[model samples]
Target: MGNRILIVDDAAFMRMMIKDILTKNGYEVVAEAADGQQAVELFKEHAPDLVTMDITMPEMDGITALKEIKTIKSDAKVIMCSAMGQQAMVIDAIQAGAKDFIVKPFQADRVLEAISKAIG
Candidate 1:
């Protein structure tokens, strides 16, 4: 995973965990945001190759951020991160143009796989 990535999650621990995995595997952690609003701002500033976005967040939600990012760059690649039982919200994310999704408690393999599949 050599791509530059943006990690967005309200939880600092989650962001750290993701950054750890991504960096260890050779991806550049371009930026991290705690909420959708910040995520959008960072997206504009950094224009990372990929974004891993948590679904439920304060100030704005992942779906809304995804939409806003898409508006900014139509070909943006985003992968939604959500806990189990968020089928409806996941569907909404897909409809909103998320390239893929990863259920949380973030498995390293699955996370890497989704990013690989999406960026490819």
Candidate 2:
């Protein structure tokens, strides 16, 4: 099977967009979460190979969720997604253990590249 992945994004459109890119590239989307809290819960449930996490969310935010996921599985691979100009949050995500990050208005190649680098 292709590398399993979990996608987290508050915006349904964004989630769909990433899911589309991943599915088309032969990645298996194990599950999806609309908020960081859900992301954490799904992470525990699915244990996907990698996660594409949005930086901002309603309940927990991506950085906090990333830390929580790290505590659950220290070697968990996560990639933070951010809109342009969220550099501070992106840096925080990296420090919190994200494997890589992709900017918003998502580019297919960049998204695929980050996922490949993180899990393969």
Candidate 3:
């Protein structure tokens, strides 16, 4: 993927791991944020081609941030990252405006496939 991407996760290691996956596969990580509030701000500033947002974060959670970002850019492409068994939250995210979602303990192939489906 050639698009500029943003990764938002409260866990530093999670962010790092995803970044590594994207960068190693030729995606550009334009920004990374530790909280949902920061993710919103960064989205406004960068308007990256895509966003990978974690569901649980400080200050604001991913669903709220997803809603806020949708308010900012109606066509914003966001993919929620959630841990296993968060089905209700996942449904809420999809309802709110997330274009797609991926589960944690990230798989490199799954990430790429989701990004491709979202951006394509």
Candidate 4:
């Protein structure tokens, strides 16, 4: 089966950007979430092969939601997304069990690379 990805971002544009990247590269987009809370809910509902999560969001930030998702399934592979200079949050996300991270204004190749690294 193709790898399933759940995308999370507060901005609809950002979510679309990610979806465009993943779909063209043969990854199945299982769902999209506008915030981390929805991300966790989608994770439960879809049980996707991977997740691309945004760090800055309303209604539960990425790190907090990452922790919650980890509680549900420790083996869940999550790759975090952040804007430049969000180093502390990125570190916290890794500690919370994220498999990897991507910096924003994303590069399609880099995003795919991270997803491949996480899922494979």
Which runs of model 3 end up more than 4 angstroms from their true locations?
none
Of candidate 4, the 10-residue stretch with the lowest lDDT total is 1-10
C-alpha lDDT of all candidate models, in order: 0.96, 0.95, 0.95, 0.92
TM-score of each: 0.97, 0.98, 0.97, 0.97
Q: Write the per-residue lDDT of candidate 4 for residues 45-91, one digit (tens) a residue.
A: 99988888999999999998889889989898999999999999999
| The 10-residue segment with the lowest total lDDT in model 3 | 1-10
RMSD of each: 1.1, 0.9, 1.1, 0.8
lDDT of 2 by residue, 10-52 (tens): 9999999999999998999999999999999999999999999
lDDT of 3 by residue, 25-91 (tens): 8999999999999999999999998999999888999999999999999988999999999999999
Better of 3 and 4 by lDDT: 3
Candidate with better lDDT, 1 vs 4: 1
Cα shift from native, residue 103, model 1 (Å): 0.7
lDDT of 1 by residue, 1-120 (tens): 349999999999999999999999999999999999999999999999999999999999999999999999999999999999999999999999999999989999999999999999
Best by lDDT: 1
Which scores greater on TM-score, model 2 or model 3?
Answer: 2
Task: Count clashing residue pairs per candidate.
Answer: 0, 0, 0, 0
Candidate 4 lDDT (Cα, whole model)? 0.92
Question: Can you tell me which runs of candidate 2 are displaced by over 4 Å?
Answer: none
